[model samples]
Target: MHKLLLVMVLAAFALPARAADPLPRATPESVGLSPERLARIGAMVETEVREGRIPGAVVAIARRGKLAYFEAHGFQDGGRSKPMPRDAIFPIASMTKVLTGATLMSVLEEGRLSLWDPVSRFFPAFAEMRVVADGNPDSTVPAARPIRVIDLARHTSGIVYGNRGTTPAHQLWQRSLGGYSRMSGGDFIAAMAKLPLLHQPGTTWEYGLSIDVLGLVIEERTDKSLGEAMAERILRPLGMQDTGFVVPEGQRGRYATPLPKDPVSGQPQDVRVGLVTPGFEGGGGQAVSTAADYIRFAQMLLNGGTLDGKRVLSRKSVEEMTRDHLSPEIANNVTLTEPQLTNFGFGITVAVRREGGSDVLGSPGMFSWNGAYGTSMWVDPKEELAVVFMASTPGLIRQHYRRVVNALVYGAIAD
Candidate 1:
């Protein structure tokens, strides 16, 4: 009898304790945030929707590894008929760069490539690149040096989106866009090589197609498409099941929609229809994700590059990626049309606090980035916090939404 009792006791002792939920929920007060203040975030978003500024939004906040608040406001379309679900998928756009950055860091951790490696190492044509002078594509000078891999990650590669400004490089970029959607990764790189750079590599910070080039680099290094590489390295491991370059037909119901027309421009808002599958998956943009999925990604970074005991990157790699990689000269030269008061990191934006005044609110060392659509996220190491704000408004109004969300989220911190 004693033997039987001993056996039962041993079996009970050997049983594992209940595993914690993958994303545990908690109250704002329990997480050192105020419930009343956090509600203001919803209130503000609600007002924006009521006023017809944005169609709808999903705002999520997590602190100290616990989800404190997550709410959806307004409708998925301008008609105010279809309600927005908390899990509605929105086009993450440029926010895809950070995921690409993380995927590249995973490759870097494997010693497959170095940040200092020249772009010519993968594409030899980048070695003999030229620079256009004074908005004149006709008057060009030989590039002093090859564009480095780091230059692409940090937007220092002098590659600009032709659609952005009116410059020689801009015009060249505009011309290149005509066939951008049809080109393979190799063809895209070849086309970019033929165009003169806007500036010498590592000299200036021009937000452009640099990350897209980095995406091609990943494909060259891994012998896989960018989407495939990211899935193997980032999405699957992070359990971001809903995030990808394409939303399947069955999942299309969850896709968010923007207003029929741009609120400001009064033109039809260019909405992404169907799957965004391309010959080469763009690292610059063209990805869709949900707030829940992205907050997990953000939490992984906030937790020092690991989440749920899975190590995506080393703490050192996270630090290097998030720290301001821009030189003072380059930073000073940054003239963003948006109201972001921040500096560029490798693939994210680092919010630096000025002594006298600033446009946005939050602690310094806050690392973040936003999509061209109304999607923004930030990981505040100081506050031990992360926030993901997702919407589908595709216009300059996104900047205002980002700013308002930032201010309201910061103000909600009772602690």
Candidate 2:
């Protein structure tokens, strides 16, 4: 009986391991990513979870308005109490710029505001704006050119975040708590007017708080708060139900906790960065959303302005918005200098796609951006793909989440 059992076990082992579990199918050969490829993506994400780099993540892929792949991994909190859900909400940081940009596009569509409108025309304090000189706090500068709505969108309006390096504008920004800390967009604009421009408008590319200024421009033109205007123009139409600055009382717990690195110990620390507060309403950083919410926003772009019968923009406007509107120098600076991580194309970061360039996947014109906490999404129109990865930790960016996503998504495409 023992000999017979051993022979049976050997025969089972020789049966070729059951083909390693068939890969999941996602789409037809002519469509987007294949199921086998998406399965590989699932495997890669699972490996990351097992390795403990990301505590939890929600990844989804949409091709031609269809959710080809949607999977969640890990936990919502570090304690592994709640599984990460597909609709988990995250702060989505600067990714809000795309929505802000879309709102600006809508304003342009309505003829209420023009991209070339001088910011000083609406806000007089910017009329006599000056740049920092010789590190002098009160140095006066001859106005080179008036800053415009386009300048803010392109990040050439000469503003700084006040923490990266020091300049006169940085100092003024530091001194102007009403702008930086006040949660109101109107108050922030008032504070911005108190400070001086860092450079002549439209001449240089500086990644500062210029978009927040654009939010003020939108509010002033519409007579509505930024949130209200966005809801009416973009959010509600796109069905981005969970994307906004303020989380309602019952939904407060749905917001993901930001895992900021501790300054003293250099370890991951749970810092509950609330979605709604008195301070972050107007800046480009206020919008909080889920991966699904942002994917819908991206799909609108991918579909050339309308998704699910909601016409957020026209194809012409989407084309213009995604096109490089900056001077060659500014584009180069965006790619090579400032952020030094990616290129910028009017409100969103455009990934450079030269064969040997900074980008490792797809062709030119791939555009995307990430939030402060590790939520990232990119749309590759050339490849007809949109990949999103959302995590509640700040350190996930440096962990190659994007690299893995790109690799798996492309790898899964069946020939």
What does candidate 2's lDDT look like per residue over 1-415, in tens digits? 9999998865543323122111122343435456766777667656755766566788877765566666777776655567777677777767777788888888889888788889987888778777666656588576677888788887888766665456655766776752474546556666766666666677676666877888778888888877888999888987778877777778866666533453234686764444437464554767778877777788888888988776899898887677766665553355432242443444423323332344445557777666666777778788777777887766534336666676677777665
Off by over 4 Å in 1: 1-22, 331-337, 342-357
RMSD of 2: 9.3
Q: For candidate 1, list the clashing residue pairs, or say none.
A: none
- Give the per-residue lDDT digits (tens) of candidate 1, residues 1-415: 9999998865553323223223567767767888898899888878888888788898889898888887888898666789988888898988898999988898888898999999999999888999988778888999887899888888888888888888666877789865575688778888988999889888887888888899888988899988899999888989998888889989988888888888888988756733666767888887889998899999999998988899888999888888777766664444373456643233333333333445677666777778888899988888999999999888898888888888888888887
Q: What C-alpha lDDT, on a 0 to 100 scale, does residue 376 get in candidate 1?
A: 91
Which lDDT values do the candidates have, in the order given?
A: 0.81, 0.67
Please report how far candidate 2 places residue 42 from its true position, in Å.
3.3
Q: Specify the highest-lDDT model's number.
A: 1
All candidates: CA RMSD in angstroms? Answer: 5.6, 9.3
Sliding window of 10 residues with minimal summed lDDT for model 1: 13-22
Q: Any residue pairs clashing in model 2, and if so which?
A: 24-35, 25-35, 26-35, 37-412, 183-278, 183-279
Q: In model 2, how large is the Cα lDDT of residue 120?
A: 83
What TM-score would you give candidate 1 relative to the actual structure?
A: 0.91
